[model samples]
Target chain A: MSSQPGTVRVPQEERTRAMRARLLEATVECLVERGFSGTSTTLVSERAGVSRGAQLHHFPTKNALVVAAVEHLTEVRGAELEKAAAALPTGRRRTRAVLQMLADHFTSPVFTAALELWVAARTDETLLAAVAPLEQRVGRQTHRLTVELLGADESRPGVRELVQATLDLVRGLGLANTITDDARRRRRILDQWAVALDDALADDDLQGETA
Target chain B: MSSQPGTVRVPQEERTRAMRARLLEATVECLVERGFSGTSTTLVSERAGVSRGAQLHHFPTKNALVVAAVEHLTEVRGAELEKAAAALPTGRRRTRAVLQMLADHFTSPVFTAALELWVAARTDETLLAAVAPLEQRVGRQTHRLTVELLGADESRPGVRELVQATLDLVRGLGLANTITDDARRRRRILDQWAVALDDALADDDLQGETA
Candidate 1:
């Protein structure tokens, strides 16, 4: 391929990017399939079909690989969330859409992978140090997007808490789902919370109606 | 001590109970600190200061030990929930108290220990089988208690879901707490949800208003 006319010039940078992406993807697969203690750099490289030396070059350590994978998943989820939020019409419908997204967000592969890291970190100082910052970064970023999605007025007495509660509530439901296949019950919970959320914002919604 | 008057009787059953209790307690400590892969029968026995023979005699396999520990924790937590519920005033204030208790319940040692099992079970088939049924049992029990505590009329259109949402929201908040120390935000979420729950039950709360 390097000798082909279109690819005559070297693609070292592209190759490096592709290699790194493969390693990260494999790392997530390993993390999701095997808990923290079970995942290793060697295992990930093997899974990605990358050599040990190449994996080492891309990520200096296993922590680096795991951390990068988590960050990558976070970015992907964040973009998905932003795209979904942007597509929604801003109003009660938008608010409901955002709440629905929150309920659905943490029950996926990313959260499952993240849960492995969080639990593994409880006993591992090195992994904890690597995971804590990334976890907080994703968390704070999610909170910001959620606040926007809810269009919740923070200055209002309980409004800010209402927005935050939606995130926490959905998170709890996801955690429960990890152990139980009760998506049906979870959807009902979401419906009920949707009502509560709508009610919490009733005054604002009313003023908007009056105006 | 066993040689003393009434104590001269060597109650094998009592000794067995004490040994089993020690093993279960150590299992939780190991789970919380070492995660699933890190936890082993050897480690648990060592931590419990019980002989390997004793540990094995009590819980023949690692799966048995881990599962029993989880079941033990669930039972203890269930009893605690019942006691807390029984202590609450049977009125609107009970509803608020119940929500607060639910928020506080999942943020404790039991939930942290359970988180380890849930993540560990994600990968291990044997562990998954052991954990899933126990998880479902506790979940159903918690739901039943939550309904009673909320004094929610499940017969009402969305009321049962409201009670379930209360549990899910608190569980999510607890999951967030594991990775980050955001107690302030959790409290705010709780306060906001309390208002929403109060509103959700505004009608039932009124019947007791005359009481």
Candidate 2:
């Protein structure tokens, strides 16, 4: 490849970026498969096919690696959610569609990996410091996105709470799924929620007009 | 005290039962304070102030100790929830009162201890086998209690889901509280949900009468 005239040499910075990405990705995988306690720098480097020295150069310790992975996990999850949001259908089915998207996000591997960290962070002060802020940011982002997607009118009574309830419901369902396959029960709950949400939002619109 | 004529000698069975309770309580404490990875049989024995021989005699392994602790934790939590339910006010504010009770249960120390076990169980087959069945039983019991407390008619369409959504919402709030003091946010969400629930249940009653 270096001999080819058209092949431009990859910059050192780009190489470093690519290596870091691999390491972070591997770290998430390890966290998911092996958990926080079981995951190690050596295992991540081996999984990423990167040398131990290079892995160390990027992330000095396991905590450092996990901290970076937290950001990466949130970014990947946020991007995926955004992409799904863009593709949602309009009209009567939008509420259910939006909810389905949120549920999918919560049940994905990234969320599972995040769950591992959240549990581990509860006891580890260093990890807690990093995870708590990112969790809040991600949470606020999800809440804002849900509000926009549902076209909820926050000025109306109970609208903001309804939006929050939707997020909390799905997150709880996600937690349920972590233990067992909760798909059938989850589907029933979501279906019922969609109807209730539509009625609540429509009622709010009516109130807005009357007031 | 043993020398007193009114004081009867404790039976062997009673002594064993008391010893088991101490160990189980200590196990929950260790799980909450130290998490799953940090919890060990030796630490639990020390915390319980029980001899190593007695701890080993009761629980041969850490897994055995945790498995027993799962049942003990559920029983303790269930007993507390039932007691709280019995004291709830029955009136216009009953719905809110019930939700507050549920929230309190989810945010309690027992729930936090269960959370540690749940996260650990995700990567452990033996713990999963024990925790999963117990979790289902507890879930069903909670759901049944919620239905009874709210006087919800399951025959009404979406009532069952509403009951479940209520549970999931509170559980999610509890999860949020694990990281930060989410009491203010939780109060608002619960307040909003109480209103929404009253409306839904009332609407169901209206439909039932008109039909």
Candidate 3:
């Protein structure tokens, strides 16, 4: 295919998809670097190497862009988690690995970006309206995935709460990391929590069998 | 309490002290309501019912004002915790109460203000310079207060980790509450953690004796 004309004749569908992906990724990068208020549509477009008009065409508003980026990142993480879960073997080790995976998710740029948006949404009504529902939906999906990943019998009395606690604990750990190097502290706590979790899970299964 | 023709003749030290308290209170209020970017020297002075000159005289800069507010709030919390701790009995019930107190501190306007400063400091160099050491100092003081509040045996193998986990867990819970009405979810996790803590504390003593 020789460049016979000014147009490269790329398919519009492919072009649009590529541009959208770039813009969303740029949004994530900006958010991870500059935070919510620091991120702007122009900045996102520039970072994406896309034209301003193209950025506007893809995302009409800042809220739309940031929200879409969050959704996109969540989807990507879901897929990664699915892949990770599929590759792992069953039992106690798997549970530990899954918890580590969950910890990684909490510590990732995905969480960092979400944190900025969450903080911004606290005061920005428009952003709150845009983010709250999307976040709720993503949060529910994450909880379900986490439950599946843990492979815990949620019907058990304490199992569900333990799983939820694990998520919340990791989330708190991640939040601590944002302010400073909480890695050492987080690891120490995680080690203790892991031991407690193993005991809890064992008790849950034993109770399940007896009941 | 004179409305005399001349100066009302309040002592300079007392007047300055009162004005400083007013400004800091206003700063926390604004941070809770409007967040960091929205809270300014002007807004703080106005809400504090103090004049601009008085505000500037007390806090030389916005960073100074905000950092002082954070330090002041932490001291206020420290005093509150000391009062509560002094009134409580030395036992498991006190442990639970301490956890609740920690939770309350995480959910207060002080935490909200700190959250704003933390997020802002992520990208703002001047703010980070002012905030990092102050935050470090507060974090150390908080950890000490927490250890005292829990009455944990720090020399024991796992007891210190458990206490640290408790702080991180509560901090995570507070962060969750910032995003949504996480009170219910937080209570559920807290109940589970409390049971675990009781067991852990008991185990630590047993292990301590065995070792």
Candidate 4:
């Protein structure tokens, strides 16, 4: 063991990785309870069952921990999206599956925690750097899904607007649903979304062909 | 002088009124900076430049402070809406004015702070009690506007859905415009709302109407 101590060790690397993971998990918990601005490094370290020194060793600053948590959230969300996408049969099934995924993920606790962190990160440079790419990923994925579902590119009349509209609808629904427990109202709102999706899908270039 | 003081002992109502106004104003400042959860009575009292004893004398509790703030916000918003409505020349103009008000208010810092408070209130009993009626007021106003704009009631074919859809559009646009600062994107989103409003105004009946 003394001989191996001079070399970089796998167990130490594994321990560091575990510590990082624990820190990320603790950040989510703290975020849920105290929100982004209210959460402190000491509180996070306490919640993670790690010493302040150990937490500092893993994440030297609050910003670093925030950036790491955002990255972790994106990875978790990406995995969930992929799993949802893979479970469905191809074509329209996938389209509906994606909508369903949007509905479910937008209201989930992890997404809510991430959203608050993102909003708070508006003034935090390190977190903002992490958020920009995740936003682009969302926009690109929306564009790609529109292309596949509409069977047309950007030139398709109202397709881009429709997709953007739907995206906004999802976000609004998420925000509103989070604050209200009126189940009937929530269902009615989502039902309207499903109805609009149906109407848009069934419409046959009513605006005429775009050049 | 002592006898005059007994004779001139003014009404307790005057002192309470002044204190309520100061407390409400201070609550708004606290909310804009610290959001809902981060806000504390001690912080609020400091911001108001009042003693903690004075704050408790006025509102008595944090929940009361939040409720008073909500009512103050509504009064302020109600006045703005009334001003906008008063400026409009006719029914269509009034509708357009109201839409603009919706866009302006939702994008404002006060409303954003109010929204955070609203979200935090979901599980908070005091907040829930304060917010429920305000939500009803929103629905009632929307219903009133629908009757005015659509020229019919919800029973008409596709009319209820159309009104719901248009409200949803405004809501969606508001949320999207919050996180992103792309003016062009904002313009495109608003244009869609304008189109939906125009369509609602133009169509007399869903079966025979032409856009």
Per-residue lDDT of candidate 2, residues B69-142 (tens digit):
86797887888888888888989889999999999989988888888888888888888988888888889999
Which candidate achieves the best lDDT against the true structure?
A: 2
Q: Which stretches of candidate 1 lie over 4 Å from their true place?
A: A1-10, A90-92, A203-211, B1-10, B90-92, B203-211
Interface RMSD of 4: 3.8
CA lDDT, every prediction? 0.79, 0.85, 0.80, 0.64
Question: Which stretches of model 4 miss by more than 4 angstroms?
Answer: A1-15, A46-51, A89-97, A122-152, A182-184, A197-211, B1-19, B37-54, B86-98, B122-129, B132-152, B156-169, B176-183, B194-211
Q: For candidate 3, write residues A1-211 as lDDT tens digits.
A: 4754435555756788888999999999999999888899999999999999988987999999999998898899889988887887686567657767878888999999998888898989999998899888887887898888767777767677777778777887888788687777776677667666666666634322356
Clashing pairs in 1: A169-B169, A171-B172, A172-B171, A172-B172
The alpha-carbon deviation from the true structure for residue B12 of candidate 4, after best TM-score superposition, in angstroms, is 7.9
Error of 2 at A92 (Å): 1.2
Number of the candidate with higher DockQ, 2 or 3? 2
Candidate 3 local lDDT, B1-211, one digit each (tens): 4666245554766788888988998998888888887888999999999989878877889999998998888889878877877776676567667777788889887888898889888878898898889888887787898887776778877677777778778877788788798877776667667666766676734322455
**What CAPRI-style quality would you assign to candidate 4?**
acceptable
Number of the predicted model whose DockQ against the real structure is largest: 2
Estimated TM-score for each candidate: 0.89, 0.92, 0.89, 0.75
User: In candidate 2, what are the lDDT values of residues A48-126, reduced to their tens digit?
Assistant: 9999998898799898898788689788788878888899999988988998899888888788888888888898999
User: Which stretches of model 3 miss by more than 4 angstroms?
Assistant: A1-10, A89-92, A204-211, B1-10, B89-92, B204-211
Interface RMSD, candidate 3?
A: 2.6
lDDT by residue (tens digit), candidate 4, A27-131: 877776666766789999998889999898778888778667756866677677767665666654455455566667666766667667656554455676776
lDDT of 1 by residue, B1-211 (tens): 7457466455766888888989998998888777777889999999999999988888999889988998898798888888888788776566657777887788887888888888778788888988998888887799898887776677666777777778777887887788677678777677667667878666443211233
lDDT of 1 at A72: 89
Structure candidate 4, residue pairs in collision: none
lDDT of 4 by residue, B24-132 (tens): 8888777766667667899888877778898897788888887778678767776676666556556544544555656666666656666666656654667777777
